[model samples]
Target: MTASWPPAPLSVDEPVGAPTLLPARAYVRAEVLAWERRHLFAGTWSCVGRVDELPAQHGVTVGDVPVLLTRDGDRTAAFANTCRHRGHELLPDGGSADGRVVVCPYHAWVYTLDGALRAAPRFRDVPGFSAADHGLVPLPVEVWHGWVFVNATGDAAPFTVHLGELAGLVAPYAPEKLKLAARHDYRVRANWKVIVENYQECYHCPRIHPELCAVSPPNSGHNYDLPGAWVGGAMDLREGAETMSLDGRSRGAFLPGVDRRRVLYLALFPDLLLSLHPDYVMTHRLRPLAPDTTRVECSWYVAEGVLDASYAERFWDRTNRQDWAACESVQRGLASPHFRPGPFAPNEDAVQRWVTLIRRAYLGTPPWEGQ
Candidate 1:
């Protein structure tokens, strides 16, 4: 849970300090991606899906690790997706099991929803093969604000520690009461870091994002470098703008305690992009597919009575495409042998800090070891 982040905004009139970016090989090399899958993604808390979206016996991939989420009695639970009988995958990729039990396709090994071994057909005579010792391996899981997250390594700090004081800042939205109203899954032909960097810095907003600029100034926000594993800040909305829609007007009723004129954007390391607005909350969950490809699941949650978010969806769909285009261009650009890593802009402090954290992880360095 240790991270380099900020909680509040710094009121600075001028941008300061430019840091060098990561090398090109980090983006285009398969070896780097392999290192990240093992060292970085394996140990971190990665979100798989939402509580409501999960089935009775759900299977998902957390980074490179396959995990299972299920309802054990009344509480939700997580376990390794591998079966003990000859090491068969319970759900293969990402899908739901039959009813409340997992039936391995290779062999008819049955496991209950909570990962308890139920039956191993035709294996009664196998020596030293006990069903008790073959239950699915358990993993640490936490359901925070309706999002279901699992730790692949089973040893990271609790999700509470991961949130720290940042939890208090997000409490005003009453996220647990919100419901998923819209979702968009994307496949971007770019490294995940490239997409993350685009989210962190708005220095390019003036040129590519005219609609966003009309609602909120690109450089009119403050960045947080708080005491948790996340970095975020808010940009005040334009005086005439009500929300991030085509017309800058709200699409639904305001959230419970979010009577504000700004929008919150932050990233929980590894892969969670959170944006809090007056009427709803939007989240982007990332999964790296290759060295140069990533899968993004973007979802928006609205308050109980507020149903539709068509306008909001349209606005972000356009904005998201623009951002993805930029990221894809950067990915293609990184393939050039002449392209050298550039220095981060003075306004990209958040990106620099977050990138530093990622670099440390990709290099297999613990957050507290080097600093």
Candidate 2:
């Protein structure tokens, strides 16, 4: 089985008008954290958790920063998950059923669901400061189709509009039907960019994913449609194409509204990667544990009411294992002294665009601005 996709190869010329290779070690600097907060985390929306997980009963922390997301009346609100007085962290892991008020474990400072200070353990003894002055810091949060997103910075472009035209790119994926399937966490020994770069291009697919390439005839083309962080590429459900797994269904089966289309991948900026086939969708989140190391979490989603346990597991397990194997191996190669920055292929323009957008946000310069 061969792919009907177009070939996209990058230029290999050196010392010309092209991107220079960045040092492999620069990803771990403390300065990068500040840059991420300001450039990446500040202005952009971040995937916090699944919409079902945001109820009052459960509280999840993103890294060491604890945050509380709960529904209030008809709306959802977010707080820094920290207490105002004594600066204690609130909501260790889980919260009460009501989650109406957050009480600091250390001093019993209480805050309303919306982060307003409601009471104190013993405020009568304190002077000058009042309950009104103490409240949980609010973090900007947004929800789209059951997915929860939060912006740590107080100031950011509205979530809906910040996405710009890119939102339209994913409109066809029917995000509303996407259901949580399976989640896998990975600790990788490479920069976060290494993992993202790996996902952004199919240049390595033919060499690393023989099973996937066999199933999706277009896997070798590397011609992907870049709708922001999401990638859409055609797959041949054409006759006789072997599948990644025997239990899996075709792409039309997963997304009922679509036609013969079979392949799609979407990455929620900074850290989330999600893809869909006919039977199920597998999503992954890559968290930067260190400059040189990252923790990756992948989840599978399927159509509601459809349960074939083995169907979802077999396909994702095989594909994910192959993906990680390739990424980890690439991480090892990045340490090589001979690994130089090469030119971008027309097919890889999406990766370059993603990198350009991120670098512009971080360094205030585009890849070809100086060239």
Candidate 2 lDDT over residue span 1-371, tens digit each: 11121211222223658764344444445556444544454335667767765666345455445667767665788777777887776766545356676677898877777778888876767778687777777877877766777765555556654554446645666666776756667787777777777777766677766666656653343335432433334344534542335423443245665533455555557666766555556667776766667778777766777655455566667766777777777667766766666667665655675565555444443111221
Off by over 4 Å in 2: 1-15, 28-34, 57-66, 72-74, 93-98, 125-129, 218-253, 365-371
Q: Candidate 1, residues 33-117: lDDT per residue as tens digits?
A: 7756654565667877788777788778776788878875558899988888788778866788648778888989998877789
State residue 67's C-alpha deviation in candidate 1, in Å: 1.4
Error of 1 at 186 (Å): 1.4
**Clash count, predicted structure 2:** 9
The lDDT of model 2 is 0.60
| Poorly placed runs, candidate 1 (over 4 Å) | 1-18, 125-129, 367-371
lDDT on C-alpha atoms for all candidate structures: 0.80, 0.60
lDDT of 2 at 59: 59
Best by TM-score: 1
- C-alpha TM-scores of all predictions: 0.91, 0.81
